[model samples]
Target: MPGKPVNTATKNERKLNFWERLYLPEVLKGLGWSIRKIWKEPSYTFQYPEEQWYPSDNYRGRPVLVQEEGKTRCVSCNLCARACPPMAISMESREIDGPKEREPVWFEIDMLRCIYCGFCEEVCPEEAIVMSKEYDLTFQDREEAIFGLDRLLVPKERLADRLAFLRKQQNPQFGSTWEYPRENNRHSLRDLTTDAESIQTEQ
Candidate 1:
């Protein structure tokens, strides 16, 4: 049988005092707090287009490919593309004659779809992709927002701070003391042969 309709409204609610019910005192108090903050606190506002704000190493702004020695560090592993939640990254890979035999023939990132979550940077095993300090992004249209290899690749020298920060974070205890050797990233017979020849010449 249905019991008497319960007084749900009165069950767990606190009764308002005279001042609270009046509401004017609470409103005045809030206004006073705001005014105090405005008068006492320093402004964080910047004059845009005139005074640009430079972000620090830890800032996650935009994902960019690392360009080392005139070529992209990415070996077309596609881990970043797969890890991207928005599916903003797309690429086509082709066989290449190099220490890293596979490279992206065409790589593009749709900035409009990219959420800037840093998933692409995090999943990249080669440390080929990393978050840069370029926060100011403006696009006239959808087509303009898509970034190609030309716009996406940043020289490793220019990204040294970010790379160092990443290394420190990845190896906190070591603090940039540990890094993968260049030789470890290559497995081609050509690279091995070159190394052996160089060793023989030195000896």
Candidate 2:
């Protein structure tokens, strides 16, 4: 059997007066405070459609693929698709005759399912995907919400700000000690050619 329940509030808590117990006075007090706040504080509401608001660099918005020259920067590593929590991203890859042999033949992202979490941007090793500052999205149908490669691809010049911000924020503490070489960006067997030649000379 349990001992008598303790009145934990007996000593610490103050008993409410008759008017306080009615609660009407407290409600009025809260209303008065709100009215005072409304009278004192200036409104921050935007005119919206007429006047657009641009977000800062750190703001996470819609994800877009980086287009370099006439081609995409993505090697179709599937890292972004795997990292997305909602599984909104999908792509089909194909082999191509280039240094970056693998490329996404078809890439699409369903904006309806996207949570704007930025996980896709975080996991892209090639810096192919990044969060843009475009927040105001309107769609009439589900089909329109699904963005294909044509809609997803943003020119590098247009995304320069976001790319620069990512580079600055993701820079390692060791500085440029381990900076990746541009030549290594290629995924071709030609990378091993130099090593093979050096080994042959040594042997």
Candidate 3:
């Protein structure tokens, strides 16, 4: 004996005829739609190199160290290197005679290893390293891809858009709770003049 049917169809399913089975009409319909789009729709593609595309402020292109007042804003804190997942950033810190007592003697980023994850940018307390808008990077060899301070440093004036975008993207609630004091990035707040005055009084 045959097994009983477990389920039955409520509505009758339509069977395809010879013409419908061939699928010529559906193929023609798709071809016609594509042709219409090709003629009517505006072309989005551009001839690169000759015609360069500008990225939006929100775009995360290459990462660059911010330069301010003809000097790198990086405090040599090494937070960015520690935060980098791919270990693309490396630097050597040296003592400097300035408000920021420490500075990176040589800073480098290996573009080959960098995943463009933006982790370095997020962890930087000084906001020294930020994602730039320059995405067109062509390297001939592996050695050439490693960017040093000369290539990595971008003037803060040129990065105004990215800076403003970052400020806008920051959560207001978080910003209020954790107040960012720029002076804190400096190694010391002790004034040299005040120290000298105190020394004179002691003498």
Candidate 4:
């Protein structure tokens, strides 16, 4: 970059051929292959809502507001808020009557501003938060875009699957914040956070 620089080839010499310049031939060839493959395997066109596509390994999608056993892993530490570069996380905490780690009475995540960098999940002392693989997060309204604790809580069945999946994605058990399970075993709500052992919220 400092010197006048070396020119191995001239600009005119780096040009494409007539067909390549036009680009139609290549496009058509790819289309032809795709059409034939789709015809052969109709499975490619996903039946969305009913059947979702397999998410990518690196795809950081929706945030799941996990309640292990019956408690959220988040201790109202605001570590995730500190960790988020985008300031997408907003949470409020309150102490319940019985003994338990502080819980987020109101937890909200602004997906529009989220970087999905997986920082919250990594920095989590309790492993209470995780990024769901499903990325098709579309909403009809802007208000819906801001995922609240209820909206973020993955359905019971999905949570079960995600917990099982996370067991495979291992890391050193967290001690700085709380003891995270190595096997990602199911903890009842009572086992997770609250003393009641199981507190049901209207989902």
Q: Please, what are the lDDT tens digits per residue for candidate 2 over residues 1-203?
A: 98987765667788999989999999999999999999899988889989889898888989999999988999998888888999999999999897999999999999999999999998788999999999998999999999999999999999989999988877465666457675655434665787678789999
Q: What's each prediction's TM-score?
A: 0.67, 0.67, 0.69, 0.57
Overall lDDT per candidate, in order of appearance: 0.91, 0.90, 0.89, 0.73
Error of 4 at 175 (Å): 20
Greater lDDT among 3 and 4 belongs to 3
Q: By TM-score, who's the top model here?
A: 3
TM-score of 1: 0.67
For lDDT, the strongest prediction is 1
Judge candidate 3 at residue 9 and give its lDDT.
50
Error of 1 at 9 (Å): 17
Off by over 4 Å in 3: 1-36, 174-203
- lDDT string for model 4 (49-149, tens) is 89767775545777777776655667776778888899999999987665555888889999888878988887676768888886777888888889887
What order do candidates take by lDDT, descending?
1, 2, 3, 4
Give me the runs in candidate 4 sitting further than 4 Å from their true place: 1-51, 56-59, 69-71, 155-157, 172-203
Scanning candidate 2 in windows of ten residues, the lowest lDDT window is 182-191
The per-prediction CA RMSD against the true structure, in angstroms, equals 7.5, 5.6, 8.6, 11.9
Cα error, candidate 2, residue 199 (Å): 22
Clashing pairs in 4: 69-187, 69-188, 69-189, 70-188, 70-189, 71-193, 190-197
**Overall local distance difference test of candidate 3:** 0.89
Q: Considering TM-score, where higher is better, how would the candidates rank from best to worst?
A: 3, 2, 1, 4
